[model samples]
Target: MKITLIIPTYNAGSLWPNVLDAIKQQTIYPDKLIVIDSGSKDETVPLASDLKNISIFNIDSKDFNHGGTRNLAVAKTLDADVIIFLTQDAILADSDAIKNLVYYFSEPLIAAVCGRQLPHKDANP
Candidate 1:
């Protein structure tokens, strides 16, 4: 299936590379990867440019609303059969992470799917 991966980022900082690297190693490569940047003052764009299948969309930070900002990215993927949304803070656990989510679509009844969000390793809890 044609899939589009969208990431919303703002000053992603040092952790961004890990996320990008994990995405690059995904077992099921996305047909397209769109980064909806909320005016990052850092190197997020420069770092993300090193990867293929990625596109960047910049917007003012004040305009960002978690839901609507993501919706904007979805609208850009009108041709995609499935749209996956990931945040810059997310570190993909394995190459199959995306594949695991996309696998459900074959069932025909699953309209959308999402993975569990795990706490960072250093979390207080």
Candidate 2:
């Protein structure tokens, strides 16, 4: 399947590299990695641009809307068989994460799937 991954990024803080690295390390790398950056003041754009299979589209921070921005990213990929949306800070826990997610699509009745999200290790319990 042609999987396209989309991530909405702002500053994305200090965890951006880890997020990108995790995606890069996935056993099933996305066919396309779309990054919609909203006028970040950090290295988010440059760092993503340096990676392969990533395409970035710039938008003003003032124009960012959670749902609208994501819809726009989806529109950019008309040929994708599966579209995966993610936040810039989401780091895949293992190499098989994407592979495992994609495996579910083999079932004819499975229309969509969501991966589990865990709290940050540093977050207060």
Candidate 3:
């Protein structure tokens, strides 16, 4: 099954690279990686451009709406059997995190799945 991963980014900040690294190391990678950036003034766009096989779409900052931006990316990924949406700051917890999540779709009754969030090592309890 074709899987597409979409991430909507603005000013993703310094941690964005780490998030992208985690995705690059995933055991089961998506067939397509799309980044919809809304006029970031930082390095978000250039950093994302460094990655190979990534499709980046830029929109005016004024035009961004949380749900609308996601829908915009979805429109371009209509051919994918599975579409995964992630926030810019969310880093996958492990190499198999996505693989584990995607496998659930194999069950005929499973329509959606959510991943558990673990606090970062630097996060205060």
Could you say which candidate leads in TM-score?
2
lDDT of each: 0.91, 0.91, 0.90
lDDT of 3 at 73: 98
| Candidate 1 Cα errors over 4 Å, as ranges | 123-125
lDDT of 2 at 91: 88
What tens-digit string does per-residue lDDT give for candidate 3 at 36-93? 9999999998988876568999999899999999999999999988889988888899
* Per-residue alpha-carbon lDDT of candidate 2 for residues 6-75, written as tens digits (9 for 90 to 100): 9999998888899889988998999999999999999999999977788999999999999999999999
Name the regions of candidate 3 deviating beyond 4 angstroms.
121-125
Report the number of clashing residue pairs per model. 0, 0, 0
How many angstroms is residue 8 displaced in model 1 relative to the true structure, after the best TM-score fit?
Answer: 0.6
Error of 2 at 80 (Å): 0.4
Instruction: Give the higher-lDDT candidate: 2 or 3.
Output: 2
TM-score between candidate 1 and the true structure: 0.94
Clashes in model 1: which pairs?
A: none
